[model samples]
Target chain A: MAIIEIEGLAKSYRVYQKKEGLRASIRGLFRRQYRTVEAVRGIDLTVEQGEFVAFLGPNGAGKTTTLKLLSGVITPTAGEARVLGHLPWKRENAYRRRFALVMGQKNQLWWDLPAAESFRLHQQIYRIEPSRFERSRDELTSLLGVRHLLSQPVRELSLGERMKMELIAALLHSPDVLFLDEPTIGLDVIAQYNIQSFLRHYQELRKITILLTSHYMKDVAALCRRVVIIAAGRIIYNGSLSGIINRYGGQKVVSLQFIDGRIPADLARFGEVILEEPPRAKIRVDRRVVPEVLSGILAGYSVEDVSVEDPPLEAVIAEIFSRNGEPPEHQVGQIPELLKEE
Target chain B: MSEHPSYLRVLLTFARNSLVRDMTFRGNFLIDAFSSMSWVFMNLGFYVLIFEYTPMLGAGTGWGKYEFFVFLATTLIINSLVQTFFMTNADEFGELIRTGSLDFALLKPIDTQFLVSLNRIEWSSLGNFAVGLLLLAYALGKIDYSPGPAQLVLYPVYVLCGVAILYSLMIALAATSVWLGRNQTLYDFWFYITNFSRYPMEIYRGPFGTPLRRVFTFLIPVLIVVNVPARMLVRPLDPRAPEDFLLPIFAILATIGSLAASRWVFGRALLSYRSASS
Candidate 1:
């Protein structure tokens, strides 16, 4: 079920240009020209019920802006957004009751108060009946392993613990759709994995829809199979995360190991000498060419071991981001073993 | 599951947590409390010295020592309380709008104002209230004034109304943050208005004093809060009550209007908002 629908969604922000010197500051006070920045360009998207979609982008790439528009924190300058058939920006009480948004850079928790107090306040805000709130509160606290954190004030909690409590508070109302903007940011590897696992389980149990925007590829890799990549405020790619990998940069890395140093020419004939360490060398090949390259490398040299891998998502994303629309294949020769993997 | 705190319990917990958090700055709290006490004594020293010059200004509407000090102490107490509780996020509210930090409060399904206002409780300011009451009692003892029942009954109402009027005016002034992008100087504006409000308007040029008196009485209700009650304590009740006794009704209406306007401006600002993405 496609519970969330967005069509031709666009948002623009007004920014005043300032001159470099003190003169401009003085002049701006009297006379100023403002420009409209298209934060989220025309975007059309549909999210199915229970779908965990990663909305990925760089800074100012409109990822957070899109979430804000979707969550009703800010209104879009143009287009329409309906969450479960309710206009988000209109902020109808019913619509607000149905969705939750959590931003990593900002906290919703009362900084000085214990998480438990915040939870009870949330219950009153949502007008939750006591029994249901208790059940949900207990379920989230135990699941997040934050039961012990209930009595301690939020300011005393560690960053990981606070982020956990943030999630619990956001979910206390059991919102049907969750919009998370970089929720795993600044968490350690273990915390990230735990949160990701918990989200997956929580989503499955409640069948809630989730749309998350994160700069962390691991967050996307672990949680979202489908991704929507927005850059410069436009949706450049949308499909499976692997599809974006393939579309942007689909070559694979082939690393070769030997007992010691190796000649460049010996391995050069099979594939590009992308990396050269003491006894190890790396070559990249298209997935289509992996078999032939592997065989040729095996036939030509005394190879210790070989491994093929797709490039890190960050590297691939950086390449795509810096290109301003240039295809990744042109840079593949320079970006060693960088498989725009699907 | 059954052990979740009740709603009242939650608010108390929130206030307690704020107290605990402020306790970490215990040194600062002591310094602040001492600073407040010192300020009151200094102001009282002048009030005492005024007796050396003469008994009273004796001009019409000129308050004697008791009425004057009581009014001054009452306004200071109300001002400190508002600054402590209601204006906790006076500085942060602008940043909240600028950075979209307010979005979290909006999402909470709670009254955004209540959450933002109570988010930080300045526990040290309770000292100011204690000292304020002590001064009021001292003045009352000197004047041989005793408020039988009704006059005392209206004291809380006046003080609370004063705080509400002050809160609304601050909100209206802070609304400029939505457009100006900053309001660091707004507290000075609020403080100045309160300064003008504390002393009765009778000691002014007619041109200035009339408008000031009208503004405090009808529009903002600053005069009605402490001055009216303090006057009621010193002066006998008339068969016909002064027009200022009804000032709270007007202030309540204006507060509602100003709060609505602030919310409207906030809504408009949200459209132009670009969260600190740069």
Candidate 2:
């Protein structure tokens, strides 16, 4: 069943345009100027139950805005969205109880109190049964390996530990759907890995739907099977993670090893030369011409070994984000040249 | 599978958590308590000096020194309750909006107003509340009149109504923070408005004072907060004047109206809340 359904959802904000200097500031007191920023411009999306979907976009591309709309933190200016069969902006208690939102840059826990106090407060707010609350709390704490830090003040804990506690506070109610906005942002490599591992394991165990927005490709690659790329307030691409590579990743890198241990001079005709070592060489060619390029390289040179592989996911994602301002039609046609430039 | 928590239980939890938080920084808590109590004592001393010269607040006003002290106690009681429960929460509401912590609050499955209004209890302000009760008892003892059963029962009830009126005003001002982004003037606005409520409505008479009295009593309705309750305890309502008889009824209606208006304003403000970007 589809757990979330969003159609033509849009949100616009009126931002004041403040000019520099005291003169402008004085004039602003009498008449302030504002412009409408279309943060989320009419996008349609859906997610089935138990699907872990990655919501990827550059900064201010409406990734967080869409999450806010779905979570009912802010209302959309146009269109409709329903999460778990409830209109999110209506902010029904039932719907709010069934879902949770976690933002990496913001905290929900009491800063001066221990995480345990916050957990208890959540229990009261969610009205979880005593046994169920205890079970979920214990299970989540143990799973995240932060049981020892429960009694410590939240401010006293390290950033990673604090985030772990935040995750626990969010999950104590056993929400069926989760919205994560950059949950691993600002964490060290090990901390990020630990969080990713916990999320993957938890999602698998519970079979809950999750929509995660992240700037980190590792987070997207590690946890999400399906990817939803949003750019400039629109859903630019929505499909499987591998499908992104198939569509935008138009070129493949070909690494060749010469048997004679000599340099090849004419290898640039096949494709753009990426690495030109004496014994080995690597070049990037369009996927469609890979066979011809390989055959030509093999025919011309004394090649002992050769391999072809797709470009890195991070590079492909970066290319997509870099072209966020352009129309979709222009993006694909320009990718080859952009990749060559890279 | 969703069981909404009892509001009372949630309030208790919020109170308990706030107490724990306050206790975590015991020095800060003690300093806050001491400072609050000291302010109330200084105010009380100022009133004492004024009463030494004046036999009554005004000619034919019925607010003698003891009666005025009762009025001051009533103001203290109401203000202390509002401060202890709602003041800090209302003030922090703006900070929450500025920092985007309000997103977490909105995501909760409880009434936003209840959660936001009662989340943090300023236990330090309760010291003033204790002093207010003591002052009320001392003033009542000094007065030559004993209260009837109805006056005694209506006293606490009207005191609550006074607190509700002040809370409604404060919350409504705090809600404007959503649109204003940072409502640093909330405390100033509250102080200016409630300063009128601290004095008995009898002092507002003649051309200049009467207009101000009418505006605060009818429009803002702040004047009735302490006046109605304090009058019920100490000053006898004039049976000849129909207005005096209707004053208590007007106070009840004002409390309800203020609460409803504040709730509507808060709801409208929430609609305009642009959650600060993450």
Candidate 3:
């Protein structure tokens, strides 16, 4: 049932090194220098059929490069990737008809024409039967709620509407595997919610495999149950969304409401003080020492109420990305200090 | 699914989409068509002025007013076909690489070269094509040469060969965009090479021009593109002139050579494409 299988996959780019001054530019014209940048460094992963997996990474973390490799847009520098039992980079027509890649920064739709025309073009490109094309086209348009806007030129549509139309155009062939790269990048809150809900609804109806890369944590949190985090061109961690909180999420926020106005000056010994108020104080405690810290705070002061919760999902994921290449011991006191800087 | 569509059907769909895209900006489309026609007319007028001073294109060459007009029309026909079908697509190819839209193109279930080469059609470029046909008719009448069946059949064949050569050249130039990151100057280079093919090949027989003429004729085969086609129609091969007999044979070789070379270059470029992933 694993539709996508990637093993020891890697991609590197040779980037020319040009100095700042005009003299360097002139010299570069004569003799150029290049440095090889490993964009994706041997990532191993698998996705089961109908699984919606979030590929999480900070900027320049090879998330998009991995997606490109799987989508057959670019060839890998090393190893192999098989999507639905087909070597993706071979780019066979049979394989292409079964998958779709939608990138947020670039548009596949023709700008000067209506979305309807682009949908028809996709029908021909994929060679979808007329009846099936019409059914999927109508279904996607209705699901995205852009039936009215389909007749208008794509350039005239709002960003959200355009993204929705782009989604509709991509899905017109009803591809079995979908790769979405930052699909909701620049949309407003409501637009983002609409897209998220639509993707969730569409996946349930189609039972298709999806691999999504997004900077927006809300997108990952809303649609994907499984999360794969990459940093510095490698997969740093891969597990369930909450598994992130349990693994790299070493800290739990313990907020206390004191009965008395007296606050302890030695609060730093219990945990890192995140917020200080007269009766209420929020502290970040190591999850492993939460019980001890809570008991110590209770034994020291008159605590009225206490709530212990995991830090925000974004905070935990950010911590995972920030702790990428450091030693384990160095990560112990890293997240809080990094959060403080933020 | 009922039946798979043919690649021809897919190309037609692309053409239709491009037509709709062009029609969306009616005013711009009209202006582009009008401006392109103006350029063609200006070139035709320039040639008319040149011929007024010189009875023949060259001292000993048989390229007089009517023959040179046919040569010019042949140039327009080949150039128009290349412009209308491939020029806009080639120009936009760099943007495709820069913006990473080539990713979507590669994802499609079709030949990448076929898709990239014909994705956009500048229908306005056909204005010059129409004028070229008109000039061909007028020149044929002026020359008072009634073409036989073989001559008529071979004329369109050579024009198609000329177009194939031009497309090969343009595609090869556009493919460089993958490595260069930007190839906006492709049209400038295209103009430089194609400007030679417009006039009679004999115009380049002087000391300096002779070597360039040989290079364009035997090496590049662009001179044969217009000259052979126009010669077959205007002047039937006298058994005495062996070059006229060799023209058809050379056209076949050039067409095959250019197509194969361009295909090899395109494949190599596609292999090297990084898809703007940095």
Candidate 4:
């Protein structure tokens, strides 16, 4: 049932080193220097059928490259990748018809034409039956609430509306697998939530396997249960969202409210106090000792209310990315040291 | 869907999409059509004035006003067809690579070459194409020429052969964008090569012209694109005439060779393409 199976899939690019000034530019005409950049360094992953997985990374962390490899937009520099039992790079018509790749910065819709025209074009490209294509188009456009804008030119639509149209165009063919690379980028919060919910509904209704790369933690939290975190061209963490919080996430926030409106002087004994007021205080503590610290604080102080929560996902991910040379003790379970450092 | 759509149907969809896109800006479409047609008219007027002072082109090359105009019209037709179908797409191919839109193109089920080559159609070029046909008719009338069965039959075949050669050349040039990253020089090279095919091949028969003629005739084979089609019409096929079978033979060979060469270059370029990152 593994819809996607990738083993050591990698992509490397040879980039030219261009110096400044006119002289260097002129000299480049005769000879140039190049360095190989390993964009995606030997990644292995698998996603079962109908699973919605989030691929998270900072800028230039190879999230997009891995998506391209799976979508067959670019061939792997080394190793193999299979989606629905098809080698992506082969790019057989059969494989292409069953999947769609949508990029946030790049548009697949024609700028001057209406989204309706693009939908019809996709129908032909994927050879979707007329009745079935119409049904899928109607369902997707209605779900995305973009039916009213179908006749307008794509350039005229707002960023969010245009993205909805793009989603409709991509789904008109009823693809079996969807590879979305930052589809919600640049949209406002409401727009992002709309897209997130729509994706969740579509995945549930169609049961299609999806792999999405996003910088927004809200997108992952709202739509995907499984999260794969890549840093420096390698997957440093791959597990559930809460698992990341438990593994690499060392700290938690504990807020307390005293009934007598008095601060505890010995609160520092329990954890590092981040904020303090007359009636309330916020402390940061290791997640492992959160229970003991909570019990001690409640037992010592006259507290009226209390809460325990993990740190924000963005902070946790940032810590993982910045811990490039740090000790491996923060890693959960076991990721070979070599894979962790790559 | 039961089976993949036929290529012809997909091509029609591309054409329809392009047409809808063109229609979106009616004013721009008109301006583009009118301006391009005016440029062709100015070129025709300049050539008409040049023929007024000269009895024949290139001193006994037998290219008189009517015959040279026929050659010019043939060049116009081939150039218009290429510009209409392929030039803009080839020119913007670099932008596609730069912006990563080529990723969507590669993800499609269709042949990448077919999709990229015919993705956009410049409907404005139809004005030039129509003018080319009128010019061809006018030149044929001036020469008092009536085509025989063979001339009428072979003319369109050679024209298609010419288009195939030009398409091959342009595709090969554009495919280099994959390796060069952004090849603005492709337009320069395309212009320089196609410019060579605009005139009659007989003009390049002298001492200095011989080498240029050989290079364009055999190596690039652009000389035959316009010359063969126009010649087959002006001078009907005569078995007694020297090189009488040249058009039939060279047209086939050039078409096949250019197409094969372009395919190889495109395949190799795809191998070297480092697609743009998100």
**Per-residue C-alpha lDDT of model 3 across residues A1-342, encoded as one tens digit per residue:** 889999999999999998999999999998999999999989899899999999998899999999989988889999888999999988888888889988888888988888898888888878888899899888888888898888999999999999999898788888899999999998899999999999999999999999999989999899999999888888877789997777667788898888986568889999888888878888988788998998898888999999998888887677677767443345544445326521
Q: After superposition, how far is residue A253 of candidate 2 from its true place, in Å?
A: 1.0
Question: lDDT for each of the candidates?
Answer: 0.74, 0.90, 0.85, 0.85
| True C-alpha contacts between chains kept, each model in order | 0.31, 0.82, 0.69, 0.78
Tens-place lDDT per residue, model 4, B1-278, is 54566778888888888888888788999999999999998999999899889978888567788988888889999888988998898888777876667888888887888888889989889888899899999989988667789888888888888988999998888888887777888779988998899988778877899999999989999999999989878762233256646656977898999999988997777666667768
Query: On a 0 to 100 scale, what is the lDDT of residue A318 in model 3?
Result: 73
- Candidate 1, B1-278: lDDT as tens digits: 22222445556756776676677678888897788778877877987898678766445554776778877778777877886776656667776766667777655544455555566677777788888888878877877657778878877766776676677667656546767777778767877777767776556447877887887766665666566556666662334355445644555565566566656665565555545652
lDDT score, residue B22, model 2? 88
Best by lDDT: 2
Each model's Cα RMSD:
4.5, 1.7, 2.3, 3.4
Docking class of 1: acceptable
DockQ per model, Cα:
0.26, 0.77, 0.62, 0.73
Please state the i-RMS of candidate 3: 2.3
**lDDT per residue, candidate 4, A57-141, as tens digits?**
8889899999888888788889889999999988788898889888888898989888998888888878888899889988888
Q: Rank the candidates by lDDT, best first.
A: 2, 3, 4, 1
Error of 1 at A154 (Å): 3.8
| Higher-DockQ candidate of 1 and 4 | 4
List the candidates' TM-scores in order: 0.85, 0.97, 0.95, 0.95
Best by TM-score: 2
Candidate 1 off by > 4 Å: A112-114, A127-138, A250-271, A276-282, A285-315, A325-342, B1-13, B23-27, B137-150, B214-221, B236-274
